[model samples]
Target: MDQNSAVWLLLVTALVLANLPFIMVNRLFLMIKVESKSFIVNMIEFLTYFGITGIFAYLLEKKVMGHVAPQGWEFYTIVFFMFMIFAFPGFIYRYNLRNYLHKA
Candidate 1:
């Protein structure tokens, strides 16, 4: 694949993978018929999954990138904002009506 297509594939992959826990947790809750939960709880679970994956990537950075330097608070600040962006789909899934349209 071309570089642009490859990068887009990676982004789509990341977003799907990053959102899986939120999806699965909500699915499991639905399976058991749980009602009324906080959005932050789902977001936190999603972030926990993303954070674990980040830790694994950091550990492998030496093999992948040759050198993985410690990042500053600014880097984390950027990542925190990025995580919010990443979580947008899940927020919409939970709050928006488009999900119902798919089933109709």
Candidate 2:
């Protein structure tokens, strides 16, 4: 694929994977079948996705641009917010949206 296509693919993949934790909790997705919806488990899963996505982005930058730039705390803060934004849809689906769709 072309460079632009590859970059877009990576971004979309990151967004989906990062949201998987929220979406898959309580068997909402077929691959996961966790019965407990504990806050600790969700928090850990979110953090794990954050770290994995960050590393993936870093490596993609290094490969595509041929160098990795130094980042500050502000950079991390922004990325964290972006990850949260990416997870927003899943959050709504699991909480508000799902409740509205119940058969009862």
Candidate 3:
């Protein structure tokens, strides 16, 4: 495979590997537990969990990508976009689909 194809494969592989459980099961689990809570409470709980995960991912990347090199704004911009992309599914789940999918 060409370099571009290989890179795309790796990115897709990593995203699916990382996100499948969160998409299929973890959200279900959280919804069950958080259903009794207020929306803001649930949102804070969810965001805190993900924020910590993001911090850990950032730290791991910093180590793996090397510390001596200062990452550019483009790097953070990409990460910000990634965070938004990763959040889209959950946004749909909680805001758009939660009430429809699981009746109170």
Candidate 4:
């Protein structure tokens, strides 16, 4: 794939993956019932998604850019925030969203 296409693919993948924890925790969009997960479990799942996405992003960087750039703390901070942003939809679903949909 072209660099541009690859970049878009990575971004979309990251967004989906980042929200997975919230989905699984809230038992949203599942075919079978899952027990509600505790806050600690949810947080762990969030961090796990972060790590997996980080690795995937790094690999994409290496493949598309031909080198892995040295990242500082700032890089990690930005990525964390981005992951949080991506998780917003799932958060809404777990909290405010379901309420609204049911009342609709």
RMSD of each: 4.8, 2.6, 6.1, 2.9
lDDT of 3 by residue, 1-104 (tens): 35465445545544443333334433433445322444455455555554555565555555555543567999768765675576566557656687688885
Clash pairs, model 4 backbone: none
Reference-based lDDT, residue 48, model 2: 81
Instruction: Please write out the lDDT profile of model 1 over residues 43-84, one tens digit for every residue.
Output: 666767667656655655554556788899998887667766
Clashing pairs in 1: none
Model 3 spans with C-alpha error above 4 angstroms: 1-35, 68-81, 102-104
- lDDT at 70, model 1: 82
lDDT by candidate, in order shown:
0.62, 0.78, 0.52, 0.79
Give candidate 2's TM-score: 0.82
**Candidate 3, RMSD to the unseen true structure:** 6.1
lDDT (tens digit, per residue) of candidate 2 on 1-104: 45696689777977896678777867533456777576667768888878888888888888877889999999999989888888889878876787798845
lDDT per residue as tens, model 4, 43-80: 77788778888888888888888989898999799889
* Number of the top-ranking candidate, with lDDT as the measure: 4
Clash statistics: count for each candidate: 0, 0, 0, 0
- Give me the displacement of residue 23 in model 2, in angstroms: 1.3
Report the error of model 1 at residue 2, Å.
Answer: 14
lDDT (Cα, 0-100) at 6 in candidate 3: 46
Regions more than 4 Å wrong, model 2: 1-3, 27-32
